[model samples]
Target chain A: EAEVAQSPRYKITEKSQAVAFWCDPISGHATLYWYRQILGQGPELLVQFQDESVVDDSQLPKDRFSAERLKGVDSTLKIQPAELGDSAMYLCASRPPGSGIGTGELFFGEGSRLTVL
Target chain B: SQKIEQNSEALNIQEGKTATLTCNYTNYSPAYLQWYRQDPGRGPVFLLLIRENEKEKRKERLKVTFDTTLKQSLFHITASQPADSATYLCALDKGSGNTPLVFGKGTRLSVIA
Candidate 1:
């Protein structure tokens, strides 16, 4: 029962500050994803990485948000000059290599909570 | 554009009863649909996945049915308990290579003992 690992379960910051969250996907997983979940809302994908390469990031607000998986194993997501609306849960998920190309269960981390005031 | 709609904002069920959640979609055909459960302040945990070619799938007390023609999927939990209370989300992946799942807002269920 390997799981995706996330750090700083909770974080509190002020607007205009920078915040970062780290995640380690399940071992042997090749696909990693970062999603944002607003209160009482479904999680939305922000970016997706296949190994060390980014496959999709059309939804990410590049002006203030950036994400990277330097070694294609662990990943980091950062938001600079945080806004009040940016307060939400950041979720990390991973898919194993043999999961049949997006048709399998996703292992999710407990998530990192961000509260911007 | 694709849209997924679940049940009402919330559902109230008694313990030892069956709880059925609905997930309907429009504007796109999905190759597979998945259900996940989320407790308060936590991430979603996968429950089950049903493929378009499959009519029904079951796991212990949990059952799922997919209707490709109607573009809908149904999730069921039998003899549910108070511990079953949470928000249930339904997501879909079109089966394209490397495509991501699109999630719905989710329906909250409260099982009373």
Candidate 2:
């Protein structure tokens, strides 16, 4: 089965430093998502992309966080000045085209864990 | 504001027993509900989905039920094993192809052998 791939499985950085995480969705998937999972809490959506276009980013903290799916296939999420509260699991997920967002299931990667000191 | 709530933070069950987890939502009407499993330090894995029009859905030893009237969903795992121990999450989508799914803080289950 095709799976979403994520890099930098673990990352540690000082507060106020930069951090980045990458994700490659399953081939042919048109929709991609980036979510942040805090310890003991559910995953929260940070951004959503549809074929290289951003669909939703209301929850994203644009002042410090940014995400891009340049090719609509792989994506990158970056935090310019990391904060201690930013430490969490960064998850990437994808969905096939034509699958209704309300009904289709998400395929998630192993995730990139970040720790800010 | 939309809110999702799971029954508890943790649950303990013996091997071969059935484990039931609950999810409730308020201030929103979801078109579909989904269940996911997450091991420590790992991303969530989709397990099952039930639609608003559907009352029940089952896959092997896993079963899910959606009650739109009550605004709740129940996830059940039968004949559970130690490997089944993990955090289970419930997600909801408003059914409009426009919005993303929202998740609830998961319930961690410990299936002892």
lDDT of 2 at B1: 94
TM-score of every model versus the real structure: 0.97, 0.97
| Candidate 1 C-alpha lDDT tens digits along B13-107 | 99999999999999978888999999998889999988888999999989999998888899999999999999999999887776788999999
DockQ values for all predictions?
0.69, 0.73
**In candidate 2, which residue ranges exceed 4 Å CA deviation?**
none
Q: Docking category for candidate 1?
A: medium
lDDT of 2 by residue, A19-78 (tens): 999999999999899999999999999999998999999999999999999877899999
Question: DockQ score of candidate 1?
Answer: 0.69
Supply candidate 1's per-residue lDDT for B95.
Answer: 74
Candidate 2 lDDT at A50 equals: 90
For residue A7, what is the lDDT in candidate 2?
91
Collision pairs in model 2: none
